[model samples]
Target: MGSGKHRWKISIYRSTGKPETRNPNPPTEFICPISGLLMADPVIVSTGQTFERACVTACKTLGYNPILKDGSIPDLSIVIPNLALKSSIFNWARASMTDPPKAVELADALKLVRPAMAENGEIENGVLGELLIGRVEEDNRGSNLLEHAESELTRRQTGFDSCESLSGSFRKTPLALATRPSCYSSCSSSSELDAPAVGACEDGEEYVGKLRSSHVYEQEQGVVGLRKATRSSEDLRLSLCTPRLLSALRPLITSKYNNIQINSVAALVNLSLQKLNKVKIVRAGFVPLLIDVLRGRFPEAQEHACGALFSLALDDANKTAIGVLGALQPLVHIMIRSESERARHDAALALYHLSLVQSNRLKLVKLGSVQLFLGMVKSGQMPGRALLILCNLAACNEGRGAMLDAGAVEFFVGLLREGGFDSESTRESCVAAISALSYGGGLRFRGLAKAAGAVEVLRDVAEQTGRERARDKARRVLEILKAREEEEEEDVDWEKVLELGFPSRTLTRVGGQSCRNSSEF
Candidate 1:
């Protein structure tokens, strides 16, 4: 009996040695499947199964495919940094259409793991990863999925549409599903699909479908065509049109084609400026929407929006509205940050226009926008803009001291010296700066001439002036300096006139001719 018991015990121990029955409660720590190191954390398998980190890692490293919960190969199986995961997902979504089903499946799997992915301050990465995965899935499924996704997106986007209906849906159900022509047509064709009849509310208002005009519909179609053509064309010709295009684009800005309203507004703004009807547009409440577009993400839209604001600001009636909107700060910001030189130039010109109003100039100075103008002058990226802004600033008595302190004289002198007298703009800016300094009581003409190299530059400019008017300007400056010097001197310097290379013979001949001319008179 004892021998029998010993044999039974041996058999029991043998049964326990089998792999499946080895441990009822497996050890938490195990060797990593990939690195052969002890697992530090639990591994989540694609099948919603957790394993030892060591095992999963080793399985991945050795090419042992792990299945996801949906019976697909795991998309992202490797442990990676949060930023790396986010970047990978973003790139995947961006290129998702080109990738095959396996990549799409992987993205979907990564998306599933996103919530758990944010263990320690990786929330942004997790959220972005999930979005990327969703994008990939939608892209892989093609048009049907895209339509559905867009419908959902449109529904979500409706909240900010308009103010008329705050408590109820912002858009009609048909419009939300309008991306798919069949869906829209079927819903519109069937009276049964008309939204569940909303009854009259306590406020005695009956729910009704917002009716749109045929003109708006046509404008929307035109805008879509223009966008598509612009996407394909190098010159974007379809996007550019004369004022006549406004008759076509204006209706699209109304509620009928709300999705394309912003685009329509931009096109109309461009056309309006071309037509020089900005005054009318600004008075019609176009400024607020245009300002919003200027703050939007699309570069082209932002550019046109700024351009429209600038054109509107040029009108005296619209200037107050622009200031009330607190537009100067954002306009200045765009001028400083925009990569487009034309946009920067327009922004500067707009500021100059605003500066025409005394209050606007003071407000801009209070806002410290003058520093940006100074930077532009010092950097010399846009000399025309700098010159205009300086001219505007000098228009204000309060701004004159600031302009001088900011080295306006130096910049104008440099422009005059480096930019030849033939340059009308440089000559104008120089003369303006000199006149401002001389009148502002802040500039001693003598000190300015000696310190800013004004004497030599003016002398050269005077000689280069083929125009009688320009010669007179240069001669006047020279005369002012000579008169100032004479007043400061004790003795006459008639003997030194020859030493100084004066045209003595020309002077003597002129004097003799003057005497003869007087006798003749």
Candidate 2:
């Protein structure tokens, strides 16, 4: 009886330790809003919602911009890694005495969110159907949305049929399935899908489907073809930038193969050039991936990633999101350290556009970018691009302060004094930066310019510079300096009159003799 009692206690302890018997309902914040599971790798999206990274990627792949319980659609463009939430989740799991939730694989995430299949095993003719038909619906503001999926289903049926008729080869079918068929299924095996027979697959949908294939070679072919198509055709760029295509291309940006990574990132750069696609690409969460590529080992992929960021930053809607997603530091690093000239150039341009946003300018200043770029200018490395960024920075108070603190006055004056830049634009940019600084930095700028001998340099530039804008900016700087000097002298004169207890103008010296002006006094 004693042995049996002991055995019962041991069994009870083991049962309590099992994962199934643990608390099934965790805290609400611990659960991913999209996956409805504990977030293993939580991230904060642009809309300020926390979700599992895989779930967000899967949703983007399906082009499902779901209206949340609050009736607000989440913007997926910029996903910042939520390490704090992730740490809290693990702590909660540990305290609850249960195994932490495992990461949701891309395949599992797709299965969870992809449109439901029909009872007859045929793909349901709704959301997935419209997507297969390549029908993109836009709101009055030209923003793409999935609101009209069911209403347009019938109208798009003929279009899908026509596309199907044109691509008679089963290999050319653009349909992408969420599930991996088993051995007994009639669907093509993974081995066959991975084959290297990339033919003239012109349709964007077909290439997207190939991109989702399990085989690396097929994905390479898909991205290469997609890149080529989107490069020249503006229509293809508009049509091919679906969440599905972007999600498929996302992981490939970090792929191990050089050809795959380079082509995938280049394809993204090509797609980002379209105005309609810019915000969509960002909302689909491409910015973080692009930042990762900028920090990655692949040089060619990094160049394309820089170009993609530059392209995306051109959109006003994307500017803040890009900066908020932690892009500024990497951009600055690449702009300074990247060996590829194209990468550095694009990174600098990306910084320029991003700094147009006031928040990004503050961020750039916080990241100590002002000094970094100023140093680049002094070293003759990307001086034009760096100056352009500095000009944008000077538009904000924090940036203006940082530029002055970094001794930018002397740098610009020195550059002008040296007088042999590659183009008139470089000189114009430096003059513009100086003008901005002088306008914003107030008395501090006046002191810095006076100390750096900027007054004489500006006079030379104002009289000799070929570009009208450069000459104008130089003259503006000179005017500011003259105004400041006059103001200082006026302050001194007023102080002298106040000390003497009478207006200085009241007592005038006529031929070394004092002449009193009582009426003026």
Candidate 3:
């Protein structure tokens, strides 16, 4: 290659010297060493290696370079932004799907189906699993389909059909069973028995009455189509298709086709794993649909909905919106009433997220969540999350007041000291709750802490803990109670809330989380 008057020699490696078949994918150096995701914010660390900024910051904070044995960097501030690499990544991402592979086309066109005979309502053993597994195998093979679909979908920017239109295929004729003709008993096995059609055929071919076609059969076809679509998109695991997929699946979820709804919800569960997809799904009207499923009679759908909401709620931005849309009422119901252990555990996890925010904490405590956590703690149902919820509640003064009134301080502390809970997280959570209640809730909390025998537990943990985090947290609580028992205290302020490592959480709990208000944004 010639550069301005200077010539440079570069060697190229190719198994076959065919330029047409040479792979065009990005080099391994372009990927973040820590995250393995494409580097949108690539930076060079002090170790002379580049990685995504977020991953670098986390790694540096842990005092080590993930890729090198160089124990720790002097500082992370020396990192440099890799703009040239970032631009190259952008170009690659844009052109990535331009040349689509043939496997993608075949996978999209593929169908898993049975003939009309399935209308008999009798499922042959192992047939359904084979069909679904076959479709999944195809989807798994066509790895590039989802990326192509996303690019194609974004280029068009089209909208999906309405709920009614989606339900069109579901409104079908009821299933009907076909009965055998009575004359079949006397019919001979073979040989040209020309007689009444029920008994025999003129050419020895069996004669039968006309079979009724069921709309149920047609609905099954629609469900199979959607299921295949969902499986393909789900297999790709890319957030790029999230919006379009949500648009397509939203209406299908409301359809009476149970299988269609199940597949759609399951697809949403997969899509919501993408951090960017959570807001889009919520905006496209998924939270309410999930809440409906959580309240539905189907335990499987309930578990899926609960799990999806739990993942979405991991993004603090979506928590209040989920709760604001009347999710709290039935979420609480599921925690208290759902028959499935997995459903109840998932519900508890969802509540753990909801309780992270101040207003939601207040609302939950007001709605009998304190008692709910108390019961869950006793039953071993997501005990870590239960304790975490109790701790988050104790962050606010009003919540602390309610929790103290409900005798949670004693329960949490006792659970910690007695080794009743085996998890380090649970034990740490109990200690953290005592810290929040001890330092910020005034003299009443100190007196209450001692009355609950928290001092003994704190001393035990501070003196005998293996985990440094737990030991430090316990020591902090012990200092607050011992050094300044009567120090002036107030509720958790906005600054304290920020210090607690929840910025986005405070945003929604306060106000202005609506996705619809574009102007405010």
Candidate 4:
């Protein structure tokens, strides 16, 4: 299916061909408790539970110590490779791989997805969606003894001819991004993160659905759709968005299948564009689940999860749940990893919205967000959201103190002068952050601000910028700079100055449309 044909992509399918050969039963001794499938390489953990080596290793890396029904985990570390189990599994696979399929198994699985094609040549999306979920569950339960669903899936993935034919019936991959040139132009660059963070499908309904259909949103997850859609209309109709749909879609968001999980998250993100859906999703217990995905290291999933959380965070009630779940560190990790610039941008935007709450603000400070923000903003990578995030964090004293300690004051001052005040919002944010740092920071803060040329930058802005808010914020920081300049005239304690905020290592190299002239102190 093309990007726009989302609604009627699936319903009935042609039996096309007989289902692949499968054995309906396998030796029980081959299964691993963790994966519920024949173990490729089993290992016994310190707790005496035998699991697929990959599963146990993943749990170990993620710190997931499983608790059985008795609520006990004997030990997590002492893992030993089970050579005996491996030999048995290899023998089982050798036998099972060539087994003939039971006629019932072939008929039943195909019947689930191949009901009847509609007159319009469309299929019911629900049909294929359900079939995919069934396949995943059956694989988890080891229900199909022959041609295990996962092995079948692997065959489809590796066999080019099979995959090509499957693609014709399924939108089996992410929609090609080339079709959405307008939506992607800015997102392809870091500039969009600096701008308003909205505009992709910022307006239409069909386009919104189409974007939500993209499974590999490694790019900004089309977040612009949610931000714009939510802002354009506030008269929400709860009936238009059903609780059942939310209930059915939530589990898909957490599915182990990345394609299914991404599409599900994007669908919810589309619904969240409505003001009411934001509260409803949070009420449906989605916030915690979404944050859990962020904590797990799924690159593509993280991009979508952060975007959904960013939209949901627009509501005040959801902010507490997100923050209380300790979402800060994971968000910071995204910024540091650069897995996808889209994930980084969305994560920053999520933090920006979450920072509206004071408690979240404190958590952000303690989590070393200031350092991350400084790194991003200083480099002008994802600068728009970075500056905006910094602006929000600058609202509180702890955030401001973190910024100073991270040596962000000088950077903000230089930013205030860059591009000759072309971006009003970024300029305003820079001024505001400077003002926050200057206030209650005593002489040291002011000295750092002045040394960064805050007085000169703010003066230039006050005279040249037309935006009253920018003019006002700049003028206030300027006043502080002038007052502090007079106070620290000759007794410039270099140590005191050095202690507050870091001096720009490249003060002479003004970045992103340089307008820098001279140092302040």
Candidate 5:
């Protein structure tokens, strides 16, 4: 390590690429049921199952309650710090001349837990668990217990120097720590986490394999190459999106290294651009990872995450799944709070497409997106995009009611009257939304439109706008406004006929045949 500050980075090596040579006979009690890795910060859930804290957080984040090997489902509602277990694991590491296990990062832990969770929380022989164990054996080349213990001692004595030399050969670490763990001090120096030169290989599979490498530099190179390859070639994107590759790329999307996280997400965005890959990516379970990046601290990564999600949302097949995966709240949050204009733009478009799904429309309405989008439009911040989403939202009953209640008719009619919109498309979106709200809008719709002076503005749109769609929508809304206005202007009050107490059949005869006075009846 470079200094006392960099000492923690050494701890990350134990969990990343190849399996570290651990004490072959370490106590089973020291291992986390969720991660199978030695526990650094163990805690007892209400179910009395002990797990690494990061693992528990991952389960909670995924809304997965894992069934341990003993077939016990951990009640994650209450977690108590297992100080004694933590101390024991620490003591074991020191006694074995191995570094104490570092807490797994939440992002990495999520990857570990996901495979097991997918198999109904069966941790033993789970897909990822097996892949991890296999990689450990393959990477270590069956190094004997004596050699492993010697290597740990040697690594500690040489400090940063050995870390640099062994950087490419280091074994992968399993599981991660907290959301933003301090384990990796970020070996940003060229001499430390140096990436192999790009263009050494053009094979996308090779790049995917590099992603699985325990070497930080190698993983960065792999993701960067994959990003470039996918960006330029459509064929490569389709070919590169295999399940194995996606599983490997998942963890890096949340890598602590800025280079890895940014490029990994950008690569995923490129991969998601392919039409066929959309559903595969979603079914493979990457939505939550992208969401993590969207809510993560890295701005560039967040931008790419939004782009990936928007690309996925372009497919009609993925809309409901994306919405069900808990994407709405974060996408809405990004629309409002992201400083990056690109992130906000993509997030808004994604929401617009997602709202095309009926359930997502209701979810958006419940999320208070109507008011949020209206406010954004009012503030002239991404007005076009926000309005487009609002247009989609208005297509549903819940969304229509929410928009009506939010004064959408007045707001949109005002926009049209003032001719404040910058583009015809934006104006068209407003008109389309108004048209949606007007359908099945009985008296209240008539009242709102009349008050907003919608008939005059819509008449202008129908007569003046060159875009045929806007013209058609305007004409439709104008029809609604005029029809309702005519109904309101009618002089007859049907209530008086009922109050007169005429015989019902006689009244029907009077209306259907010739009108007759009550005296004739």
Candidate 6:
């Protein structure tokens, strides 16, 4: 018996009306000893008289000794020899032959020899036999045979010798024989490769008689082949229209498929949005579909859908289109209800974009969305998202007042004191608030500065302003308030001002008038 490290390269030479080369180099060919089929380069044999060093090693690890010999004729009576030799030959032929029909014919020929070889004692207890049995059991139990085979093979002793003679066969030890049945059970038919064999065995007729049935092999082979073919075809097909396929797959988003669909949709939408006219297609329908998907039953799906919508909403046209579909409420619902961080973030972003448009801004305010947004900021959940929404909310006149009435300044001040305003979003929100107050209707300005402690908060932010932008904004607001104070000072009643601050000035004037009257008298 050989170890797994030494692999045998078997070559089967089949007459394709051409001279075949057999050598240690390229274009190697051999005639399978059992099936007499022409095999080509890199033939791997686990049984029969042509087993290579590596194949012998592998078989030895499995507690079996495989033989090897050079011959033009194959012995078809031996089950294991014929099956292993025929497999090697067919594999070689399939690799070398460019014509599909030729390969198919070779595969068919190998199939024909399978049963005859299986009927003999040669195929029983062989690697394929153990593999087949294990596959069948696995299929029944819906387990994996390869995993089981690997574990079993690991427990066996495997080694190799130099100058190894290929004539003798290695026999399994008592322990190996004892474990064979269990190995077979472990590999029974659930393995991916077993499908084809099962399909091959579906027929009622007995295949090889005593050793094994042909119908079982045929059915297993059929199923296995079909599965492999389906996977291969799907791989090729999906690669072609991946973008469109992903976009269409959006509705199918679920916890099980959320990542796939989201990634797919994101790629497609991103690519499409880059193009000028294609953006319309996405805006017209994709936005709504994404919004609808946000209502999914799974948190993952909602998360992914919200992310996709956020990417789409980055486009101005798409944002307006989303607003037109009345997406604000549904988005808000997801933001508030869904616990997914991604969903909440995206929903907040969508709201922020919607607020940029005046009509949508008013609508959001009218819906009492400002209160909810302010509450989100106050709660300290998703502070970045909340700040973005707040910034956009401050962009509108009514929205600014609503935010003021909703106590946004106090909440924002709390955020600043709590260090929540350290982020860029919070800083941006602060800037937007300052701008809105400075230019917003005077009542809003007075109300905000005079309200509980807004001016102090503003002064704090102003003190912390190291950046030119922040300092400039703070300077502008301060200048506007100072100018308003000066204007109010000029309009004050002089008489009332004197009475309050200088009653003596009025008394002096009255004394001077009385002195002049006395002089006249």
Task: State the lDDT of candidate 2 residue by residue for 1-521, as single tens digits.
Answer: 99999999978977887554466578999998767899999998754678999988776655454445543445565679999999999998887776888999999987876642232133422234324323321112111111111111111110111122111111111123211101111222233244343554456679878888998767878877776666556567778888877887888888888778777877787677565688999998888888888888888778778878887885667889999999999989998998976677667767766776678988888888888888898888877778777877886788888888878888889888988986666777787778777753388888889899998999998798396656766776787678778877976776676667654354557677776664453
lDDT (C-alpha, whole model) for all candidates = 0.46, 0.68, 0.53, 0.54, 0.69, 0.45
Give me candidate 3's TM-score against the actual structure: 0.51
lDDT of 1 at 116: 31
Error at 174, model 6, angstroms = 76
Least lDDT summed over 10 consecutive residues: which range in candidate 3?
176-185
Stretches off by above 4 angstroms in model 6 are 1-278, 417-425, 492-521
Q: Candidate 4's C-alpha lDDT?
A: 0.54
Model 2 / residue 24 / CA error / Å: 72
Residues 1-521 of candidate 1 have per-residue lDDT tens digits of: 99999999978976886533322322222322223222334454422234444444333322233332222233123233233333443454334322211221334334433433343222332133223322323123234322432222112211111222111211212111111111111111112222222221211011011112344444344554443332222233223442334334444444333335544544444334321254556655666666665566655455555656665664455666787777787778777888855456456556655665557777777777666776865676554455555555655665766766666667667777777443454355455445444442233546756798877877886788554333444555555666567765746576685566444232236446532322223
- Compose the digit string of candidate 6's lDDT tens values, residues 225-276: 3222222232222232233433333333331333333333333332332213
lDDT of 5: 0.69
What order do you get sorting by lDDT, best first? 5, 2, 4, 3, 1, 6
Candidate 2: clashing pairs of residues: 61-244, 76-283, 77-282, 77-283
Clashes per model (N, Cα, C within 3 A): 11, 4, 0, 8, 16, 59
**Per-model TM-score on C-alpha atoms:** 0.42, 0.58, 0.51, 0.46, 0.58, 0.45
- Give the per-residue lDDT of model 3 (tens digit) for 296-348: 65565676677678767755567778878878778778877778655665566
What are the runs in model 3 whose C-alpha is more than 4 Å off?
A: 1-245, 486-521
Clashes of 2: 4
RMSD in Å for all candidates: 28.7, 21.2, 20.7, 27.6, 26.1, 32.3
User: On TM-score, who's better, 1 or 3?
Assistant: 3
How many residue pairs clash in model 5? Answer: 16
Better of 4 and 6 by TM-score: 4
